[model samples]
Structures are given as structure tokens and as C-alpha cells.
Target: AQSVAQPEDQVNVAEGNPLTVKCTYSVSGNPYLFWYVQYPNRGLQFLLKYITGDNLVKGSYGFEAEFNKSQTSFHLKKPSALVSDSALYFCAVRDTKTGFQKLVFGTGTRLLVSP
Candidate 1:
């Protein structure tokens, strides 16, 4: 009973502006959260993860995320978006009871950037 949903199929962004991809989750117990990015024909790259402490967690490529407990959500954010940032974003959740290693990925949210 652990899963994630990325509501937006894709997001179009400019070269420089704030960007966000939304995610929501359902789990039996406390969840381990993660964010990953995928390039064309590639697997996912770890962006960030939330195991415990600090609602705000920072990660690779100037990306960060806020873990909201009450809302049962983790949303990824970036102050300045880049053309290079154009890729697919995935939000995931791992069940704490299940060793927190099995990641359930979202359908994936494509991020398109234009120069």
C-alpha cells in the first residue's frame, strides 16, 4: 500500500525561472522520499532523498525538496530553472517497514525547457 502519483504529465519552462513538479503519496507507515531525474533514453539520476530530519533537503544540480508530513507530500523545487534541466522528473516513496529500499516511482513528469 505504498505508491506515488505525479499529476502533471509534463511541464514547459523557460530558460530561467522557478520550477516545480508536484507529487503525492500513499503509504502504510512513515515514508522515505526521493526525487530523481531522467534524460532521454536514460535511467533516473538521484536528485534528493528524505530519510529523516529537516523538511528541506538539498541535492544535485541546485535542486531541493520539502517533505511535508501532514500533507503526505514531497514537492521538488528549484529557484532558477535551466535549459540543461530539461528532462523527466520522478517522485518516489519507499516504505519504512519494507527496509525503505524499494522505490515506487511516479509515472514521470517531463520537464521541457526552451532557450
Candidate 2:
């Protein structure tokens, strides 16, 4: 079985400061990882993904993630965080070994960027 873990329940940061949300994953075979952000009363928005290729993957809203194979981690990062970036973030893993590409998601990590 595959699983994702967001160790921190919440990450507090001041506006304009750099921020990071941690995520680690477990899988039987090669892992397909993804990050999603959700705003109040809104669906999850795609942030970034790591299927294969470069160790560092960039995504929307000045966000990027480094895929660390050794640590089995894909932590989301931003040089500067905005108040608008405050939201609930999720880390997911797609189990390609199964017929259906079901995504296993972590509990969630809430980001609070204060002005």
C-alpha cells in the first residue's frame, strides 16, 4: 500500500518570508507524487507533480518542490509567501501498480501566512 504523510499540522509564516511544507511518501514501487492546495470553499488546485525527470519541479504561484529519492520526500517551497497563499495543502501518491490510478492523500497541512 502507498501512503503520504505531512508531519506538520500547520506551518506559520509571515508574509514575504520563505516557506516550506514538508511531505514524505511511501510506495511499493516507483512513486508518482503530487501537491495540491485548497482555498476556503474551493476544490483542490493542482500545485505540482513528480512522476519522473528532474529532482526539482516548479509549479504555479512561485512554488517549487525538490524530489529527494534518498529521503523519499517532496517538500513544497516558495521563496516568498503571500497572505493569499495561506491554504490547506495536501500531498498525494498515485499507485500505478493498480489498474485505477487512485491517489492516496495525506491528512493535510494548513499554511498560515500573516501580513
Number of the top-ranking candidate, with lDDT as the measure: 2
lDDT by residue for model 2 over 1-115, one digit each (tens)? 8999999999999999999999999988888999999999999999999999999999999999999999999999999999999999999999766658799999999999999
- Backbone clash total for model 2 is 0
Local accuracy by lDDT, each model: 0.90, 0.95
Model 1: worst 10 consecutive residues (lDDT sum): 94-103
Task: Give the clashing residue pairs of candidate 1, or none.
Answer: none
Predicted structure with the largest TM-score when compared to the true one: 2
lDDT tens string, model 1, 6-112?
99999988878899889998988777889999999998899999989999999999999998889988999999899999999999988666574778899999998
Worst 10 residues of 2 by lDDT: 95-104
